[model samples]
Target: MTEVRKGRTAKRAASRAVKRRALAIAADGALILYFLFALFPVVWMVILSLKPANELFSTYFSFTPTLDSYRTVLGAGEDEGVPFVRFFVNSLVVSLGAVGLSLVIGLPAAYAAARWRFRGSENLMFTLLSFRFAPELTVIIPLFVLYQQLGLFDTYVGMIWVLQLVTLPLIVWIMRSYFADLSPELEQAALLDGYTRKQAFFRVALPLVKPGIAAVSLLAFIFAWNNFVFPLILTSSEAQTVTVGALSFLGGDRPKYNLTAAAALVSVIPPLLLALTIQRYLVRGLSFGAVKS
Candidate 1:
């Protein structure tokens, strides 16, 4: 009777193990399907960009691939009419400029808001946060007229200044949280060691939050880089970024889908490369102060 019971138990355990393996395989397959579904549009864009102009509308996967679209966008090939290089460079300058200005202005502001307790300080911080939730369209018309009257139309200064609306609040709010998460005891210890308040901030607090700065700066840059409304309305030619410049490929009598696809894919490279390069800092920054232990 004992021998028979042991044999039955072993057989049941083997059957249960096989079922668990099958379930694991099914779950993995489902996750893979979801990933592919999410990635399909990007994959399609790459494929379309690689296809020659003649094969752009081809239904099947047998189309010939060429570098003509990329060449044209980069100003090295047959199509020289559109200066994509200028547009791309403009984006880099404008995005970096906006983020730089935001850091300069927002960092001190965030630290103050974090450390001080002035009357109406909460109201002031809330007011700054409110700017982000307000839609850009509501104020663009007034801003448009204002920029025109002030001689700031279609200029780098105008675009970078205006993007402060997008980047500033984000930096201030996130950095405020980072500063708050830090224990005041650290700065106090520095103070006891003969460091002035300013010195404490620069030598102690600032160094500690470097990862957070890296993470938030990248976020701000991505937002500023992808901004459409400000650049679309404010810039006509000289300072137009890739967000608007990509549309130029479709401007003529007939839209060139291949060129448009090529422009977009090329435009994605810089931001993608930046995110990949600083991914470690970004991860650390994001996870900063998430757990006490």
Candidate 2:
């Protein structure tokens, strides 16, 4: 009787183990499929970028690859390749400047909104957030007029200022949540220990939210970098970002799809590198305050 029971128990354990392995395999298969789905566009973009102009419209996957497309887009292969390098630099400058200014202004604003209650503070924060909800087209014409009058049109300063509409609210809202998740007692303790309010913020409160800062700054930078409508309408050449400049290839007689693809892949490098550099902090920042003890 005892031997029979032991054999039955062993069979049941083996069955459960087989089921668990099958489930794990199914989950991994699903993940791999999703990853491929997400990566297909990028793969296709790369393939498009590699194909020579003649091969661009070919339906078949097999192709002779060449670097001419990349060289042309970089201004080395063509005499007048639309100044893509300049546009790339403009994107970097404008995006960085926007993020920098947002950090300077939004950090304090977020901390203030998180830590204190003042008259109209809610209204003020809501008003700032409302900028995100409204479509940019609604205000672009007025802004165009204003930029023309103020002589901010096609200037780096103008692009950065306009991008505050994209960057500032994100920083303020996300960092405000970070600040709120923090215990005020930490800052209060710093104050009691002879730290000024400003010092407490810089030393105690700020360091605690470093992960959030890194994450939000990356997001703000990407938003600023990808913005197209503002740059397209506001700037002609001097400060046109890659988003607008990439379209320049489409201007000449035949649309240079190969050059456009190469330009796009090149433009993706900065934000991709930035994300990889700070990926650790990004995960922590996103997960922070998601759960409570």
Candidate 3:
């Protein structure tokens, strides 16, 4: 009887283990399918970019690949295209600039929001987040008129300033949460050691959240970099970023899908490289910020 009881228990445990493994396998299979579905368009675009213009529409997978589209966009081919390098630079500058400005302003604001609460504090934070919820188009027309009036149209400074809408709220809210998660006792201890509040923040509390800052900054930069409607209506040639510049290949004489694909792929390089380089810091930041102290 004892031996039979032990055998039954072992069989039940083995059956449960099999079910768990089966469930895990099913979940992984679903995730893989989703990844492939999401990646299909990107792969197709890359293939289109590599194919010769004449071969672009001929077949999906059976075409002679060429570098002519890349060469054209980069100004190495006989057929000239937009100066994509300039657009790439403009994107880098505007995205980085907006994120920098947001950090300078939003960091302190986030700290204040995290550390203290005054009247209308919740309302004010709500107002900041509201910027994220509102459609850019709702304000773009008025902004266009205002930009023209203020001589901000098609200017780097203007582009960076406009992107505050994208970066500022994100930085403030995320950093606010991170700062809140950190224990106030750490900063208080520094204050007792004769450090000023500012010094305590700069020397003690700030260093602890480095991971969160790096992750959020990278995210904000990507958002600013990928913004399309802003560049489309706000900038022309002089200050346009890659988001708009890549589309230029699709215009005039005849549509150039191959070159458009190449330009699109080229534009992805900056964000992808940046994300890869900072991936470790981003992961660290996320992990560190998640735990409440």
> Which numbered prediction scores highest in lDDT against the true structure?
2
TM-score sort, best first:
1, 3, 2
True-vs-predicted CA distance for residue 24, candidate 2, Å: 5.6
Q: TM-scores of all models?
A: 0.92, 0.89, 0.89
Model 3 spans with C-alpha error above 4 angstroms = 1-29, 77-79, 290-293
What's model 2's lDDT at 286? 88
- By TM-score, the best candidate is 1
Q: Compared with the true structure, what per-residue lDDT tens digits does model 3 show for residues 192-282?
A: 9999999988998789888888999988988999999999999988999999988887889878899889989988888889889889888
RMSD of 1: 2.5
Report residue 232 deviation for candidate 2 (angstroms). 1.0
Per-candidate clashes come to: 0, 0, 1
- Tell me the tens digit of each residue's lDDT in model 2 across 159-219: 9999999999989988998999999999889989999999999999999999999999999
Q: Write the per-residue lDDT of candidate 1 for residues 1-293, one digit (tens) a residue.
A: 99999999999999999999999999999999999999999888888788887776655477878888888888752264677889999999999999999999998888888899888988888888888889999989999999999999999999999999999999998888888888999999999999999999989988999889988999999999999999999988899999999888887876787788899999898889989999988999998944110
Indicate the TM-score of model 3: 0.89
Worst 10 residues of 3 by lDDT: 284-293
